[model samples]
Target: MKDHHQHELDSRYRRAALPPLGALRCFEAAARLGSFTQAARELHLTHGAVSRAVRSIEDALAVELFERRSQRVFLTAAGERLRDAAGAAFDVLAAAVRELREPPGAPALVLSCEPTLLMRWLIPRLPGFHARHPGIALRLVAGGGPVEFDGVDLAIRRDDFDWGRRVHAQRLFEERVGPVCSAGYRQQHLQGQGRGARWDDGAALLHSATRPGAWADWSRAARRRLPAGQNQSFEHFYFSLQAAVAGVGVAIGPWQLVRDDIDAGVLVAPMGFLADGSAYHLLSPRPIQAGSVGAQLLAWLCEQA
Candidate 1:
């Protein structure tokens, strides 16, 4: 009686558009391994069951996932693309499961900042940070502007920030600004154009729209002035640097953000006179413990500065 009812329920579900989760899993595994037998063994199911699951998934998606020939199943181009996405989904699911299984104790460290800052500055130094404090786990939350810090632990801010009633406040470090361009670009246009050359003397300046006064600052320091009719603007400093990298123009880059690029010989400064301080602040709701990872990060940035 139970088997009959189960069969009826399964038939009803099959009539619906929803494909079985097990079938999707089997297909993903089969595509990754390029063999039904291998997928069956890994999934602890019979080879026939695995093959049926793969076929079911392909039919549901209306896409050809594999091409079988000479007793071997090879994933199609579509299957290869799907495999990467499926694998990523599996990883996220597994991580979520693991987190649920573990007992929760300390609050997760949620770091909010711009994508450029995270990619160019923070990510490279994260290895040393992990080595020193394995207990601290980081969640990189990125955006163009600051999000309301309701659920966030800390913010690495470069914009206007209001402490309001928050208990946390510390200056991370100031970012020094200077002329930065690809080494190739520096050698080409800026080569014979050093201290003797006027700023407007055929120098292609990459303007950053975000930092309104960067050109003015650079012009003053370089002992030159931008022509009244000259105009160029980029949405962000990151994009401005990218333009500079492609030899489009010379950009004023923040030392804190592009230090590694400079060190790696990817970018170089023609004149070092533009290194002026612009503060970046570390903000949170409350003060961290003296020896905590938050404190460590603060200390590290200061030392780097």
Candidate 2:
């Protein structure tokens, strides 16, 4: 009798009035990105397929969800309402999927961090964390900007942008930035330059595509004007820093990221580091319980900083 009752409940759920999951997914993506073309790219579906999926949803609901004007898409009133509902639903589903994929009996904390920090700083210190807390498994994903703590337990980011007020944040350390170069390059090109000397126009200026304004920001904070020089851009901040270490050029280096290099004589900060009015922060969705693995990791990080 219990089995029969359970089977009936499942059948009822199957017969519920709901749009096709695929259509809902397509509609949600289109609404969120405000571009069917971009949504198609994200979903790896053809643009026409995405359009048709959205059209099917509109037909079923009998409402236009988007307004098309000047080759741009804008969400209509109905779209905004549906977007909020669909986005929330997707977030819940995604979190569930992540939980389901984890190995049984092995609890893990997922930490999202900025790419350069992960590469240059956190990774080198992870051995210490593992040695201290062997029972807790740590998973790291590289990211920046506003963190979506769906599957992430913690995120480390510099306070360069607003990450909204929903999450609890703790200050890690103040950011200090300065121009750094390989020791060889400093000796050859900047041997006679004294502290806070004007930047030379002969040396190449290394730029990161990720942080194009880093040099400018440092210049502004140091109250000095940067003279024009040969510019070389790298795809990532870490790459630019590495280029600086390889004697390619001088790059704006965050003190934390280049501290070991400077201490080891691999790099030199002729101008020294200056506060850029930003600080690194550890962010989480909720206050971490004291003595928990997350809290342990947080405390360790604070000690390291």
Candidate 3:
């Protein structure tokens, strides 16, 4: 049971191959540019190729599409009708592709990332991303766990879990972690052995409630037992790192999160860095194909990492 509109669309699709896309493109360029020679130059084709393509379209439609004059061309009645229709059709096609390649909300590319990664890593690097991709409007949302594919187009997370086929995953880099504290805090609180201080030297332990065992895991890697010291816990890693940055306590810091601070001398990695075998991964909805804005972003992230 086909409706009239459905039948018409079906017939259009069935007969779409008549003139062929190549011939239509050539015709459009020739019509718009006013010369087959100019159209060939714009298309990087031989002038004869453009002429043949135009002739092919006219032959297929059984109608002349141009009026040849002394070293000039004009659109015939049929040619004028086709030029308008083809121009409109190509415009619609181009718009559809632009909409599909970009994130659903026109210019904005919605991103979901772990709060710590967003605050400490991604946000800092966003200026370069903007410079490289001025057309991609980035909208960042902070949270962690399985990517909510509802409205978000991409996510950055540090996890080893499977995201399934609906999501495309690319490993950016492995996570290295260690204890970090403000340089001023170390100078004020730790007396002498600030050069290679032990965690047992009475610095407060800033714990992330989300990852309570971070200290213990780091301890195992460094092969040192952390003393049971004054404990302060924060609900999230971002807060815990902030507490450390504020000189309140030592926080188990992922290398990427604390790298800039450490390099800038704001934070000191007392125990250096250790790899815990985890990685930061870029996740995007699988519906986004290669060469799209999301895919381009993933490539940029990998390069930056």
Q: What are the lDDT figures for the candidates, one per model? A: 0.70, 0.83, 0.80
Which stretches in model 3 have alpha-carbon errors above 4 Å? Answer: 1-107, 160-162, 188-197
| Candidate number with greatest TM-score | 2
Clashing residue pairs, candidate 3?
none
Model 1 TM:
0.60
Give per-residue CA lDDT, model 1, range 147-261, as digits (tens): 4677777777764444466546677766567777777665555534656643444567778777778878867766665644445688777677766666666888887777787
For lDDT, candidate 1 versus 2, the one ahead is 2
For model 1, the local distance difference test gives: 0.70
RMSD of 2: 16.1
TM-score of 2: 0.64
Question: Which candidate number would show the highest lDDT if scored against the true structure?
Answer: 2
Task: Give the count of colliding residue pairs in each prediction.
Answer: 0, 0, 0
Candidate 1 regions with alpha-carbon error over 4 angstroms: 1-105, 144-147, 159-167, 191-194, 197-200, 227-231, 273-277
Report the C-alpha displacement of residue 9, candidate 1, in angstroms: 34
lDDT (0-100) at residue 80 of candidate 1? 57
